[model samples]
Target: MILRLALGLFAALALALFVQPQAARAAYPCPGGPGPGEVQVGVSGGSHGVAAVPICDRAQGGGGGGGSEVYYRYGSIAWHPDADDVWMEGSYDGPNTAERTALAACNQAMGGGCTSIGEWHNSSMRIFRDRSGALWSGWHGDGGVHSKKTLADCSAKQLLPCEVLGTYSSSKNRHLPKPTARKLYAVGAWVEGTEGFDSRLYIASGQRDAATAERLALDACTKATRQRCAILAFVGNGVIQTYRLGTGDQSATVESNAKRAAQAAQANCKKRGQACTLQRVYDSRTPGEFVHDFMAPAAK
Candidate 1:
């Protein structure tokens, strides 16, 4: 009887050991199996494949054959006087690192003074332009709040003529492309503050041609002050200078050559006995080209 009892116990123990679930033998087993942001995918032969999954939380992590790892993502937008751009980054190792990375990328591509337009983790962003020519951007994890916030913010800023451009999701797309480069024309106008008049300054940019830009600037100035505004500068393919005389007389002369534009402006101002201080210069070229020609140093 004693021998039979010992044999039965031994048989049961062998069966239990052989049929144990593979999950019980996992290399890095959590007490509650896989936690949030984790999924157990079954591989062939009944082995549990640990994988990281996208979670609503800002920080996300996953498990794989090698081990567990964390991921970070961010999105951003930047704008200047005439253009704007967006950026996204992921696979970072620290908190808020993605925000800095995105900002750096945006500033590098769009030049300095770029703002931190938006940031997110496992989320996306969209931008809009209002009829009044204001720009707005918003971001959200699940794509619900962004639209509402974008419109609300634009309204808060009193931006009219608003329309959504599109949405960009890191989960669905790679990086957003750069804004299109184009030749730009601009106009600058300034009204002198006289005893009965308030001083005014107005600028219009990104016009297709110099004439159109000048017209727009003048119209804007007249609408704002109800007084005639003289064009201070015109830019297209080169820079031009405009000046106002002390006698309340304004003169506009276009020079095809940018090199002589400033000199010509000063000469005109001097001939009219003006201080030559009311002259303004404007550039009519793509921002990139303008930076290269003026901001960058001459080749040795």
Candidate 2:
């Protein structure tokens, strides 16, 4: 149980980073501006960590995914690794929001004058900090090259006692797709009840199977800031929907579109004559490949 608790705490920390679109880093995303995609929810004030953080571990699935590209060009990061080791990280759709979220989160965690950040599209970013508190950033379209550059950056600066602060892939980050592959959609979250992007709610589409789709979405949720991830649902076609049942159970559904999905969720909760709320709905509009699942070509 102790071991499980420890691991849960670790995952919580990861979730914090994964969903931190509310952190401090701003000026770094890029002069180019925010890219394509949608942010379902926003985060508010507070310092969050594992102890009281929101998360739920209900399920899993599998796949081997490596590398990411921001062909969507939408992720912006807010980061401040102050020389005193006071730092925080968050993500956003553009520089302004990224900076706002990062600063809010960072100040809450530990007061600092954090004012640095970077931006990447579907690509990756890595940071290395030295004992002196000096920091270097590495960016590349390729995750592997970006990683190597991070280490080389410390070397170039001759910054000893250097260590990696964190690594990031933009919001749409995912592996390159196969031409003839089944498309799947999946949803996951750190905490079960809270919905939208702030809860580390994430979706992965166009996977090979239910396992792969769930794995991708869960993996993305884990890497981003959130509570703890639970696999909400998977489907081969239609849309993915999440909700809070009248009994308070967290669940999801696959419908043909956004309106139908929301209506279906509402109806399900209504069956109990209890309170229910439609949390999130990812229809054809959500972005990414919307196509594989346990339900096969469609949901039953």
Candidate 3:
């Protein structure tokens, strides 16, 4: 069993890691499952009775019982355990490109819900859904039975029986929901005081893009001051801190958390012999908006 697993994993890495596989013109059909282009399929290995092994093409000959002809293919699943089912279905096969592309699409799908999540690479992804409708993904190198082992692992953790969602190859964006067309975030402000220096910051989070985020922020500021609002800064998903110095300079920082950003900004201000006051703090996990007055309490 160990030898078989090692062989299969070797095949998966060969197909996915070394040279990029020739791009398929389109998805092909399979009878019972998701078809060649969809769920999974492979070559040479088919003669040996391997289903989704990607044909051992990347490595030197002599594997999967092959001596001369060699071919293997790789796959990646854009699976984030914390992601919603609708958000985790987008992915492709490139080694470095998979995670980045997946996150771009899924982040759009979930509206910046992936801030705290991480990513991964895998040759095969086994999807399982428990009776309660919670979805789980299992990953291993790649082989016909390799996917099965991962599926078993996934099933073991479930409180009930799981339904297999099929093993797939290459890039599969089939199930990703359309992005809400919402921008992630935007920050802006408009003047209001007699000196026209009201430093209050307004924000618009979860817009479709930077332009949208800024527009939303400015619009809110306009509503509040009944004047044209200018863009302060474009801050995205993270620990957002807005601050004002005694010198009347307004700035914001993006850090790991509210306190870190506040402290860093205050430290920077203190170096210049200026008073630093915290205007607002926004949650790093939140994909939403936050607003501020001209000034707020100092950081505790």
By lDDT, the best candidate is 3
CA lDDT, every model vs. true structure? 0.41, 0.39, 0.43
Over 184-286, each residue of candidate 1 has an lDDT whose tens digit, in order, gives 6656554433322333335666675546776777777777677766665554444444444455444433342444655655666675567543354545542
Give the RMSD in angstroms, all C-alphas superposed, for model 1.
27.4
Give candidates' CA RMSD values in order: 27.4, 21.9, 17.5
- Best candidate, TM-score-wise? 1
Residues forming the 10-long window of minimal summed lDDT in candidate 2: 1-10
Q: Mark the regions of model 3 whose C-alpha exceeds 4 Å error after superposition.
A: 1-186, 191-195, 206-212, 226-228, 246-248, 270-275, 284-291, 296-300
Candidate 2 Cα outliers beyond 4 Å, as residue runs: 1-182, 189-200, 225-228, 244-251, 284-286, 289-300
Candidate 3: tens digits of C-alpha lDDT, residues 72-128: 333333433233243333344433354455566666655454421122222445555
| Order of models, best TM-score first | 1, 3, 2
Superposed Cα deviation of residue 122, candidate 2 (Å):
54
10 residues in a row with least lDDT, candidate 1: 5-14
Candidate 1, lDDT over the whole model: 0.41
